[model samples]
Target: MDKQEQALGLLQAAVESMGGQVRPGQQEMVKHVVEALDEERHLLVQAGTGTGKSMGYLIPALAYAQTSPKPVIVSTATLALQSQIVGRDVPRLLESLKGKLSRPMDVSLLKGRSNYLCQYKLGGGYPDEDEGALFSMDEKPPASGTVYSPLANEVMKLREWAEHTETGDRDELVPGVSDKAWRQVSVSAMECLGSQKCPMADECFSEMARARASEADVVITNHALLAVSAFEGLNVLPDFDVAIIDEAHELQDRVTSSVAGALSARMVLTAAGGAKRHCAVNVDELTKAAHRLEKSLTGIPTGLMDKGLPEEMGIALNDIVEQSRLVLALTKPEANAPADGGRQTARSQLQAIMDDAIRMLETEERREVLYTTRPREFVDGRGYVESDPGTPATLNVAPLSVAGKLREGLFDGRTVVLTSATLAIGAQFDSVAGSLGLMGAGAPSWEGVDVGSPFDYPKQGILYVAKHLPKPGRQLSAETLDEIEELITASGGGALVLFTSKRSAEEAAEILRPRLDAEILCQGEGSMKSLVEQFAADRDSCLFGTMTLWQGVDVPGDSCRLVIIDKIPFPRPDDPISKARTEDIARHGGNGFMQVSATHAAIRLAQGAGRLIRSVNDKGVVAVLDSRMATARYGTFLKGSLPPMWPTVDKKTILGVLKRLKP
Candidate 1:
């Protein structure tokens, strides 16, 4: 049989083994993937939920791995998806393909070094003075004052697990330890004493995993790791003939973050303190440089530096660079001196600070954007704040567009197949294609295919745009909250209200919690999984949240009969990166707003609307209370990106329809 036919047969048998039927969309994805691999064309496939898309790609990857000289790398955007590919899909397909392929296939999950435990760090062991200075990843348990401490206990559990875990992967620990605890045991790529330098290198969990992955028939990794290799132009993953990227929509953002760097006042002070400890020279100059940086950054207005850093800022950074060099020269490790982990780690960190300072000063790089902003405590793509008067500003530098970087580094040498449910905005791949660098001249040749979803979107759902509602401003309008209440009351619950900010979600939930008859569950109240479980089990319960709830959530059936959006989740108007890119496009006489801002809202709106109708049996109404989604010229484009649900602006009709859904 031809490779395509063999892949189909394998998928068929594999689905049957699991007592499931393969969808037409899955077959089309597999066929296209095989052709893409064979013909050396990059592919973007949009396979909807319930299409068995995971198995669709896995079937071909396994088949190709059986015969190809190089393994196929499967990349995903999230740890959840990565875990699913490695722990579930690969094993199921391999079992069904047993004795059916040219050779027995094996696979490995490759995570960043920080995701694994460092035995050296855990045991407080180090190689003799010649090497193994200091290198550990992140985190520390909170200080305990009580008889029992949660973080401390978690750390203790990790120490116990370290003795028996063969893989040493942090994810394997059931009901996993806190990141704070994990930091005490793991090592980052930057800080890690490499296999040759660390005494525990032979038994290193990260190294062993790499060895296995290098030898496996298939490899699973995340986009962040893949982006590192692409931008750094290094072999982070084993050489592969093809790369199948799942959740391809997230690739650009991941790449941008990977290539970005930041310089902070806290970083400067910390480095100054460390250098002062290890420097053999008069430390006054380095300390003064650090003080200059901290002072220069104070009260710098938070926004894009359209004309580049202020003169004082530039002088301070230059001083730090030159002064750090002097200190580093004095502290340079001597050939006969004993190795000190603290000294080495401090030097490495100071060097890194200098490197970022240099990168930040490169204002001539037209492709990059630079800005000053308060540092954030990023969590769950929500809770993005840690603002205070004392919080010094940070200078951040990132690519204005990751398209060219991705085209040259990610797609040039490999047979690439990218897939996501929301790749084709406005029912056309042109917008997404251009953004991914597949449309312009000299770009790599690529094709897009929307296998589409299995769900009968129109029959299974309704898209209700409240054209009469007051326009949204900084806060959710009273009219919008009223609509939410009526919708919840009419449906009798099972509403996932997605908002643009935490304040809106909280205000709505609080105002309606007393008025509503059903249970109200808000995000960040407890664990997301726990809250979701509560929402899922009680059909009459409602869950309200921000961006994190827009996608990667699955609450099928009657439990999710209504989804509400407070507004279009556009990139903030003041977002420095988006603003810079928009200006750049406008300078070239393009539709800057439509291309950057509107396109961003389209993708996110699609993901938010996708929360409804997760399965063929799931029936719900996606209510967009933001009148802009109906009144704006770009509304049509945003709607096109969503499921082709029966749309309406008739509030009474929608209310009546929702009322019938009540038990």
Candidate 2:
């Protein structure tokens, strides 16, 4: 049989072996992927959940890679998906296709340098004020004056693991290390000394991974690395014949973050401390420059710097750039400098920070937007402002749009397949395609195919909009909280409530905790993984969280039967980047509200609603508490983005359904 037929046969056999049948959506996806690869054309496929999209794309890509000269690259938006593809799907496919494939298929998963342990950074001491204080007992105490006993223990464990582990991947660590602890041993791409210049070059984990990718038949990577490779013109990833981007809906956000740069007072102090220790450069000069920048930033209001930055702030940034360059030049390695990895690593880090500072000062790029903002604590969502004593405002820079860059750099001359469950906003792919820079004139022709879900949405789920409720104000109203409590009570928990902000989540959790009979878990109480695990294990429990839970959560079975969204997930009015982008769209004669705000909310709503009915046997209720969903003109557009679940606005109807579904 031909390769396509053989590939399909293998897929069928593999699914049967797993006690399942080939889903029609999966078959359709595979067919489209194969055709796109054969013709070297771009294709957009929206394969819904339970469609086995991973296997769908992998089979075709692997079959093609078996005989193709160039490797096939699969880029995912999340590390979870990347690990799923590499650790689970690829291995399963390889085992299933052992004797059926035309040739051997070698797969390699490549991540950014920061994801791997940097032996150079680990063996070498950390920069004076870096996150490695817990590892440096011989030196003076860290300037931060804080000592973490847990961090010290974690570092020792990592050192032992480093000696015995072959891959040196951070993910391989048992009971994964905290981000703060990981930062002590890992170095980002910017901080890495070129492999050729490093003494541990031969054993570098990132370099070895890249080498394997270069020779492998299939390479798996994330959207951030792909963005770096394609947009920034980086040669980190190997050249490929085609790319399959999973979770394609997240591509734009991931790419924006990948290309973004920031400058902060804390960063300057850390870099200066490193230079002071390694280069023996006086830190006072650099410290003074940082202080000037901090002072200038403090005087300015936090928002987009679209019009122009203050003259004093501009002068301060220039001074910082100059001071950093002088420090780097003056601190050149002495002939008798210690040859230990610590000294080299410190110097490299200092250089990287200087490079970043220089790049942050480049304001001539019209396509880039600049802003001054306060940093938020990731766990609690508390903002740190300059008025908070030592806290300093950050200057941010990022591309206004990645579409042009993605179109020219990624889609050109390469067979591209973009697949995601939420790609179609308002029952159309045009918004997604346009956002990805694929719709402009002279752009390569592309086709979209939405292989509908296998599960019967209307039979398995209920979409309940609270039409009788008042319009949602700035916060969750008392009446809305009462409704949520009643729904949870009726369902006997097993609910996942998604909020647009942390405060709202906390408020709802507080009000519900006292009233509900089941356990209520909030986001800041623990890590997302642990919370999700706890929620899954406790079938009667409910989880309340903000944006992260909206998309990243997956809890099938009776553990999640009720999904509640407190409001439409609109972009905050003060979000500088979103506001600027909306204004820019309006200037170009596009409906900014519909294109930017509504489309964003629609995608998020779909994701929130998706928390219910994860499997064919799974049945649940998705209650959107926002009355605007039923009263507003745009409600129809938003509802169109969700699954075709049986709809209802009657409270009694939803309450009865929830009671019947309760365990």
Which number leads on TM-score? 1
Per-residue lDDT of candidate 2, residues 33-108 (tens digit):
8888888889999988899999999999888887888899999998888988899888877887777776777999
In model 2, which regions exceed 4 Å deviation?
Answer: 125-148, 282-286, 331-364, 377-391
Candidate 1 structure quality by residue, lDDT tens digits, 1-663? 887998899888888888887689999999999889889999999988778888888888888887787878999988888998888877777887787788888899999999998888777642222222222313553456633356556666787788799999988999887676777777667667666567678889999999999999889999988888777877678887699999888887777877788887678777777666655446677677777777877877788988888888898888878877777777787665553555665677778788788877775664678888886665543335646646568888888887887788788888899999889875578777787788788988888898988899889899999999888998667888889999999999989999998877877888899989989999889888898888889999999998888985799888899999999888887799889989999999999999888988988998999898878788889999989988999999888888899999999999998988766
Q: Quantify how close model 2 is to the true structure by its C-alpha RMSD in Å.
A: 3.8
Clashing pairs in 2: 124-342
How high is each candidate's TM-score?
0.93, 0.93
Q: What is the model-wide C-alpha lDDT for candidate 1?
A: 0.82
The Cα local distance difference test for each model comes to 0.82, 0.84
